[model samples]
Target chain A: MQQTNRLRPFFENITFDRDDNELVLNFGPQHPSAHGQLRLMLHLQQEQVVKAHPDIGYLHRGIEKMAENMIYNEFMPTTDRTDYIAASSNNYGFALAVERLIDVKVPRRAKVIRMMLLEINRLISHLFWLATTALDIGAMTVFLYAFREREYLLDLIEDYCGARLTHSAIRIGGVPLDIPDSFLIDLKRFLDNMPQNLKDYEDLIDQNRIWKMRMENVGIIPTQMALSWGCTGPMLRASGVQWDIRKEEPYELYDEVEFDVPYSDKCDNYARYKIYMAEMRESTKILYQTIDMYKECVEKNETALMAHAPQYISAPKLDLMTQNYSLMQHFVLVTQGMRPPVGEVYAATESPKGELGYYINSQGDAYPYRLKMRAPSFWHTGVLTDLLPGSYIPDVVSIIGTTNIVFGEVDR
Target chain B: MRRYSPKDNVQKKPYYTDRYYVAPQVPKLDVESDEEFASDLAAIESKFTVSESYIQLDQLVVYIDIADNLGVLELLRDERAYTQLSELSAIDWLAKDGKFEIFYQLLSMSRRKRIRIKAYIDEAQPVKSVQSLWRSADWSEREMYDMFGIKLINHPFPKRILMPDDWEGFPLRKSYPLQGDEAASWYEVDKIFGKEHRETIGAELRDCAKVDRYDTERFSRLGFEVPKGADISGGEKRKKVQYQEDGGVFLIDRFDEEKTVIIRDKDR
Candidate 1:
């Protein structure tokens, strides 16, 4: 083995079998297209890849280990860094996992708000993926267009949660706080104008021949293959699987919200793209419904969302010097984290990528015993080793981006 | 705002009594223990949630003894439904007294269900190699090795994935002291600016050490015994100063904070 290892490169010039050849090439660990710090060892015969092996863990931050040590409520903030893109979704999943462990029902208003932010996050996540994927395939204008709408959504999110990107707006039993009126108005305005922006995206790349050639039939994971690989979200939907966690499990106010689960028979990159666009449109519909629901809830009562909610414990009496009991309650809730039961629960949500599941094990402590993130990116990325083989080198980037695997989620 | 409901959207009816390929329901098997695990595994398979497992989309995960990890992985990838080797990772239970666990997240796109294969390895012998089934396991396994000190018995090219090759020790392990040079900076700047930045490191040290007039009443409200003439800010700085002297300096203090110097006239 040592002799062969030393002579391996020398033997490359003298091929024993010319007709059937294999060349091992390192694709990343630094390549811009592997999505993040992922490395792919591709065994190829000319332009057709014979075998593609993925070498991940470049982004692993040991979040699970960290979660095990932190209190359940203290762990909520950590969820924000998991996906980082659709952070609220991760936070929601984590919070829901904890909530399920404690068997606490989220209030009606909080449920609606959770659904609203999650759907909006889903739209933004898909937009980033779509924009970047298109750019990877050579459509540059789509980035600006996609980001324009994405920025609008981010702004709306920032206004609501006072943070963008990793908005840890979700808490154990409910949302961190209720959405203000102006935030809702801005969201409505954005959703109102999103259809045209989506059309603009379609106009720029949907039917373009080059775009079709690059995405259509590339990285095709058939229905059987997709299911076998545990593919979820758009990737599974692209393969014609009609399963979606939001519809199946009906978490938060998903059952109350009206939207469509878009699937495609095409089972290719084009199908994945189409599925996402359809999903964005469906999200817009959900947003409109959420806005209307928010309005109705506001008009029907002057009470805050948490006004009638059961307190984990009674807040301390109004300050001796000042009668600001509400402030005291808010402070108490913020400082000491929520308590969950000593049990385990798995909560899955239909993130734009796939079935984003959060498995939380609570030992009745403030923190969790285990926090497992079922990242869609990890599932999507896992298929690349199977999909990349028999495809050209350039198609590698196409497959990677189309898979929409976020390294943050993958490595986490 | 308009609510959209697709009239043509065909929703699949969810089955109520289906238990074909659902999650293994083994009476909530003691997740902490590995005794009689195979029997539990059998029970889990039989009590799966769905009746027709083939039609359902589920992720199939099988937890095995660390000794039998490689064998089970090979069987699942070669014999069972697993075709796509998606992700392989490990989790550290430094705080827990039980065995350290490694999770292999597998996807059989053909079956449409995902499963997590778990194996427990003792700290004494933290090595298991499953790189043969999926070559992708090589680096992830190495990463698990690098961070948690979990060895990969026969991994072809096991090495660090995130940290540099020369990194001193695994950063992910809970037992590993959070007292690394990186942690020093993180502890400092994370408080101010509401976000952590390089500058926050210095700000934290200064804030911690900054001398503040001791108010016994305010100190009482904080539920702490008042230290005589000791400012809270001074206390913060003293900690930083001691920390800096202990060869774990953040190195940002030399430039960021002002150094006190006693000026004496040359004539005197």
Candidate 2:
């Protein structure tokens, strides 16, 4: 039977064509396993999915539109809302793009502090992914254990920035404040005990039969398909591609840090999970290195906070209160904002999820003429429509969980 | 400590001169330079126009004519091995040429290099879609269509992805208002539920509204002025005939009782 789009005289429009033995299921928009408002329309032939169409934008807030209207500094807080899971990464990425546009050089100590915050954010984000993905695959113990460590990291972030989730701790030319003295003590403690907590998480699900059965061979995507679909981060790395922006592009002080990019040829859900766990361990190593560098800075009595460019970067609050010239500079920076050069630049950081980039086109204005956020999750979500067709209905949950698609970045 | 001046050469800055600030090499590709890549692309087709190319912050950017976007992208992907279409986005240039500049950020994994392909199209003209080449272009092109209203010709499914299907104008355009426009008023909550069904839900809604009204009065008495544009009347005008039977769920309305409790507690 041929499907027809014939108009009816007195009836409302019918959307789908009637077919026998075919079921259409709306998987999300409000399903817990869907992970943050992703709605997939799955066409199932009995139990196997025939076709899956992702219906995104349930969380769209027009963040790019908002960026154009606000001043440079004013938009920093809004970047926090883009990928709220790793807000510090989003902040640093946006700041890097603006700093590139204006050709500003950050202080050495500021760069170290920024790198420390970014690695800490990576730990927080990967832990959340582990907890949520493990729970989605029926390992409830891993979820409980992951969140416990995540809480300790969030507390350290809160002590530094006053906000736990949305810590807009980075400024354009540097970081907003110096790391509190207690932050070093607390972070050192967390780093000391992190390996044991990771071991606990691994002990729960690493060797379990059920966990292996569900995640080992399911949702297998090859290296070529992953690349063609623009899969970055662990998804691309899981397919045996050693493309990490931190190593390749080396933004900030990442070049100074020594860490390995983990990859696996399995190219399945299990490989992706292992890559996330491996990444967390590497982040811990990076954290220890940063802490040592920070101690060196403290011993040398170095200024490890904001940059010294008074014309472009804002002055510190203490300086603004004391000096007349610093006060005027702060007032101008807050009100008028700095104007970047008339050109375009794309700055990318290896975010917890993937290569989170900000492409800014400046017309020498306080606000960007155009700001485009190339969120890694946006491309990862695009691959789902191609990935879910051959898999079974039950496997759909595992595939979605493995992709780690957060709607905040996908919809922004 | 020395004060830095913008007039000073950037190379003289201590931050820029630091040993840790080594500029990473843009990995060697099959082609020696961007010129070789452009020449190779031009060799594939005479219609391909490769304009002035520059290195911005260590990444190569190439400008291409809008008409040969697909041809150039195919050459870059198939022959040159820039497999990943990392990002596809549009920039609205309303103030300048009244044109929209579309950017395709491509990455070559084999070479570990990034190149940006840019094509400028007028607001009305449609750019050929590269969805056939890169599957990731599907959503990114849809986003361009949704945000800037720049149509991508031959796109598989050209429906609005971010905005509602019935959204009037593109929000990312410079001309579009930041706070939204008249189309926002088109969403009527009452219309979502039909009039017959709305009356059934209307009674419960009114009870909530009555509580809100009581709180508004209490707040005003406490010297807090109602914010402008606040619905202080609490949807009273939109309310239908109230259902008379009370569920008697609340022994006393919380808003009303709170006022008396505050007065008595102050006396004590």
Candidate 3:
């Protein structure tokens, strides 16, 4: 067949202009792959997206506003709603910020227990990411397999705290309840089983051509771009920046634990996925070490789980029941909550999602004066406007999944 | 119901204080106390004017001119190597000082130090957008506008990020009632059905707990269900809820409890 440019001038005059050919597709606020009320307004020039604007705040419950009215202790449970996937991380982040504000030192046993909960939460959240990302990328078997393991992890958290999703396991100053006797046994069992499950997941999709094709080179956030765009956690790590808050800022027993931060410089979705996989392994290593540390504390007969700052922390239940003075103090502490010093502190913790920071300003009042949740998902969501352009429409799902953004955090 | 009070001026009254309450303050150290912070401040002050700088909680806090946000942030990023803009937002100081204190938290992974650039702007004053310096500031500045109604100077697409485009008032303002204002009560009614239907919809409850379950108008009780305006003084009869239509779904089989199979064993 022979093709000629004889009618090129005639065709050029009548052909559709770039503006005329451009189409706008509204991806979500309803779609499952949108990952919880993330409405993406994608402007497409044919199959390639010209621009993407993430429309957020479908889940904004005015948590910051609510935090203002509630007492310091009351706000801990509300923090769980920020990143519901790993609720304990949100709990600990707020608790750590308040602890810093009040200058309270946690008992060693509680510190060890908090570290274990954080790592378990990291594992649970990462497994959830694995399940959902695979499900979104059209691999169903891994979703089922990943969730099967996720249930066991959630059960471990359930043993620690009563609730699974909104586990407010952490408290201001110290933990409320001591770690259960069965918890360590269950954690030891789960830590042993997690490695093989992680291996099984890699075997399922690591080398699969379609999975690689979807994730290998998609959503490449360069190292400089990531920093400028406020990327953290795996997003920052995958971009080759070796910055982890756990290592840089040692809160609780993170300084005592031995674990490596997993990072790769591929700067793509696959690198982020591999980082998440390696991080779960690292979390297992941390859990094993922390459990041993916890046992040593138990052997030393350090039974005090809550910090003994009577002015700040509530007295132990046994003391409250027996002693009238302790009961009176408990009543006062509960009625008019502990007043932190009038100062603003920006405390960042490496949440399962990213650097989940709480910028709490106190007015020497029971309630927080102004509270801002620096959610990792919010920046990751904002970066989409820059990342989504010049990519195919289908890649949007893979990118969103890899970022691991939950709207609970984004629209908080 | 509790006695009605004026909601508008609630937050205007200063926070309660007493003779017994001595406001404790966090110790703020001089910037020169930390050698690393001293150098960082020296570099920042060389090019731009710094109104005040101090170290609080190991973070260097600098109060800069609101206009010089972009220049200072650019210098920090390009020159000082403080790559990440970790947090950016405004605090409501309107009750105390009638000004909003805007803070920008910049982090340097290489140096392992944090510096905060803060500026105070009068209420409703427009602040310069740092979206050019840090891309993350795009949504953040929009959020500041959406929440506090703080206008931006030169932001590209300065629309509301959280609230709807037609939202009436700034929700995060200290004066704004936490329970909601009059405009909030009528927001959804006006949004979904237009302002003309405001009378038809009445007013939305500010508190969900106040809604009566047995009102025979809106709510439908689980066991004691009845029609919209049913007179139930004698008490409505208890009934089992029907899951499907009377004729059943066309292709779907009706469930018979006698023959229903339950997977009791785990992982069946």
Candidate number achieving the greatest lDDT relative to the actual structure: 3
Tens digits of per-residue lDDT, candidate 1, B1-268, equal 8966432211211223234623221124333244333333454445332111111122334555667666666666665556655456565554465457677766544544455666667765756676666545654566567767777677776777556565666665655533334543444355444454554224333223344346542233233445554466544333223224344546643432236555698776
lDDT of 2: 0.81
Task: Compare the candidates by TM-score and give the number of the best one.
Answer: 3
lDDT of 1 by residue, A117-233 (tens): 998899899899888888888889998899889998898898888999889888766775778768877887888789999999999998899888888888888776675556778
**Which ranges of candidate 1 are over 4 A from the true structure?**
A1-35, A41-46, A302-336, B1-98, B101-173, B179-268
lDDT (10s digit) by residue, model 3, range A311-374 = 8888899999999989998887787778889988999999988999999999888878899999
Better of 1 and 2 by lDDT: 2
Which candidate would rank higher by TM-score, 1 or 3? 3
After the best TM-score superposition of candidate 3, give how far the Cα of residue B242 lies from its true spot, in angstroms: 21
* TM-score of every candidate relative to the true structure: 0.67, 0.82, 0.90
Chain B only, TM-score of each candidate: 0.48, 0.59, 0.75
DockQ of 2: 0.25
Candidate whose DockQ is highest: 3
lDDT scores in order: 0.68, 0.81, 0.88
* lDDT of candidate 2 at residue A257, scale 0 to 100: 84
Docking class of 3: acceptable
